[model samples]
Target: MAERLADWKQSLDVALFATRMNFRSHLVHPGEVVLANLGALVQAVSGAAVFMLALSTTGVVHGWTLAQWAVLTGFTTVARALWNTVFFGTLDIPDMVRSGELDHYLVRPANPLMLILFSKVDTDVWVEIVIGLGMMGVALQASGAEVGAAVLLFIPVALVGSALVFAAMHLAVTSLSFWLRYDAMLSMLVWRFDSFAQLPMSFYPKWVVAVFSTVVPFAFVGYYPCLYILGKTDSPFVWAFPLAGPLLLIPAVLLWRRGIARYSSTGS
Candidate 1:
């Protein structure tokens, strides 16, 4: 227990250091942070505007009301903010592999994957985070849903789980860099799968829903969380999706380990 506690503390310290270093690096240019937040706010607004405008005209999207869609958008924007700021570093695996920069991480005392994933931070994503939560709160109020224990407990837990699921997914896909000489396009393609979660999964056919739920599992990121909050379905199964993140991480970590075993530095 002592050893595990110590390890957790060390990891936490490393994470903090990484975040500070990343901030310092970016802050070296005084206007960079401001520009980042401005750009991110515009991006967030554009996405919400597109959906809200359409919903105003149509009243609903494939059975999802405007307010319900806002909940999903909140979940997606926050999760995407997380993915962009943190897990997105997994996409760097290809560049690290090709340049043999991965070797530096491997030789470090810390876990290589943890080091890589936590090595940078995008501070600007706070804009998206704020917008996402604002949308959720305002929409929930308009929809007459109470922001009680469930909302306080569930949304955050769901977001953490959602982030983990995609982190593992990206790690697994980018691990392909160990075999392929160039994996940029493939990684980008997999990363784009988040767009599917920007709206309700009900809009798609059953097979597409099945694929996202299991094969790729991006559905857990937005659809299920919002479903529960919106009271759209009575199915108890919605509660189980958060567990899927850690479960899916099993195979993803296995693939990553295998890729590490097979890797040979370019110098080889």
Candidate 2:
């Protein structure tokens, strides 16, 4: 048993080492990193600017102050970072599957899924972290909701939950590549679904809210937990939302594994 545990630990270390090496290789291509960073910066800045403009026009919408609203925006931006970092293969899965690239991935010494997912780190995504946190700080000031150390305690939990939701959503989307040969429309569909996550779930109809909150649960990563942080929802559900994102991932992953089994390699 001890040998088995050691083997597992060694495998984990090798995975981590390989990931570090992949990141280092990208760093050598400074131009690509610069271009990617620029794009991410533009995305983060545009998002924050638009949210700030909306908040200014409304002053306070649905009892949420600008700071509170900004916190929601930050949460969504963080979700973007999580999505790109952990589940980006969703966008690339179809291409890999159709090109017989998946065969190579399957034969790799490391876990093929982990290697494919985390091998390419998006360096520019840090821009979102900077912009989002800056907006969150401004929102905190505007809302006069000085978060205590206790609030910081919830941050790690929220981050983990957000990651789980990202993985679940992206993996589910990518799993369709197993059977769907033409996936050119998949990216557009993902973007459309993600657009709903960018805004407060409260502004939508109750049924829409129910769809996201209970069915898909994207709300747990950004909207619902932020509502609690902003003191908007006093419901017990908000307090339990952080766990929802992670719990939902179990079924999603199982489905993804099943899909993998069904994957028929495209000889091309």
User: What's the TM for model 2?
Assistant: 0.88
lDDT for model 1: 0.81
lDDT at 259, model 1: 89
lDDT, candidate 1, at 22: 79
TM per candidate comes to 0.91, 0.88
- The residue pairs in collision within model 2 are 67-139
Q: Count clashing residue pairs per candidate.
A: 0, 1
After the best TM-score superposition of candidate 2, give how far the Cα of residue 63 lies from its true spot, in angstroms: 2.9
lDDT of 2 by residue, 132-214 (tens): 77777677667876577756777667767876786777676676777676764774576568767767876788998898877
What lDDT score is found at residue 238 in candidate 2? 56
